[model samples]
Target: ELFYPKNKQHWREWLFNNHHRKDAVWLVFYKKQSDRKTISWSDAVDEALCFGWIDSKVESIDKESYKQYFCQRKPNSTWSKINKEKIEKLISTNQMTKAGFKAVERAKQNGSWTILDQVEALILPEDLKQALAGYKNALEYFDGLSKSNKKMLLYWIISAKRQETRQKRINELAELAGKGQKPKQFR
Candidate 1:
């Protein structure tokens, strides 16, 4: 269901009450068409993560507002550096719920908890970088892509669960980029 919280307190209350419910999906509204103030996305995310939820897809509802989808964090969901940092802060503040701690434990156990650095520090894996650099067409194409596109490509490679799979994906990505085509997942 969709939820519109005026501020962090309301969001916290909602998450505290609903975070344990597996069937719940929340679409949190932010911004407003009129003068009414609303909780900022950052604050909402803070509360959500404290309850072991993650923000997913977001959609615009009007000129002045949008809704962000939030769901329980799955066992293997990859963590973004930004979200990881926020979780750390929430932990230190003693805001993490039992469910939140369990999610962290699951991520740690599965080896995805610390896989990515902040976006600005993120680069394509060495093997992927070398492959691209060796192919002039791919190198040119990659250099021309927007920052988000480049990040998406690198992220896809990084998220691979095995070394062989990562290498295979890097090769495919290099070949696709060389041909001026987007990865199927990215496309």
Candidate 2:
């Protein structure tokens, strides 16, 4: 469902009433310059975290506003570094609801809470680095990529459980990067 929350409190009320039942919500937020006042994205995220929800894809609705999708955190959802910090703050501030604490506990029990944290500083694997070295353009392109893009590529490659799968991904990445393209998943 789409929601236009006027402010942080409005969003909090909506989540309080519907967080347990709604599968997802598309929240509309006004741009800073928009005449219509709305909750800022940062505040919205903090509020969602309080309810054990997470935000994902954002799409522009118009010049004035955009919509972001928020949903209940899945059992296997991996927590991001920023979200982990946010969770800590929320906990310290006593803003986290029971549902939010439950979600954090589930992640801790399943070991997803610290998985991303351990790899927060994504390192380029030697094998992938060697492969990219063979393609100068690929190396240059990979080097110039934004941190998030590089992290996504590295995570996708490293997350492969099998050695052969990881090697295949490295080769594919080199080939794609040589062509000045990112992985299809990222694109």
Runs off by more than 4 Å, candidate 2:
124-149, 161-164, 171-187
* lDDT, residue 115, candidate 2: 68
lDDT of 1 by residue, 1-187 (tens): 7887888998889888878765456555645456766888888888888888888888888777778888888888888878889988999999988888888899999876866663346466678779887766998888788888887777878878799998898889888888988789888
Off by over 4 Å in 1: 30-33, 118-120, 133-147, 160-168, 176-187
61-160 per-residue lDDT for model 2 (tens digits): 9998999999999988889889999999999999999989999999999987876763578678889989998886999999898988888888888678
Measured with C-alpha atoms, the lDDT of residue 109 in candidate 1 is 94
Write down the lDDT that model 1 would get: 0.81
Q: After superposition, how far is residue 160 of candidate 1 from its true place, in Å?
A: 4.3
lDDT of 1 at 18: 79
Per lDDT, the best of the predicted structures is: 2
Clashing pairs in 1: none
Q: What's the TM-score of every candidate structure?
A: 0.78, 0.78
Clashing residue pairs in candidate 2 are none
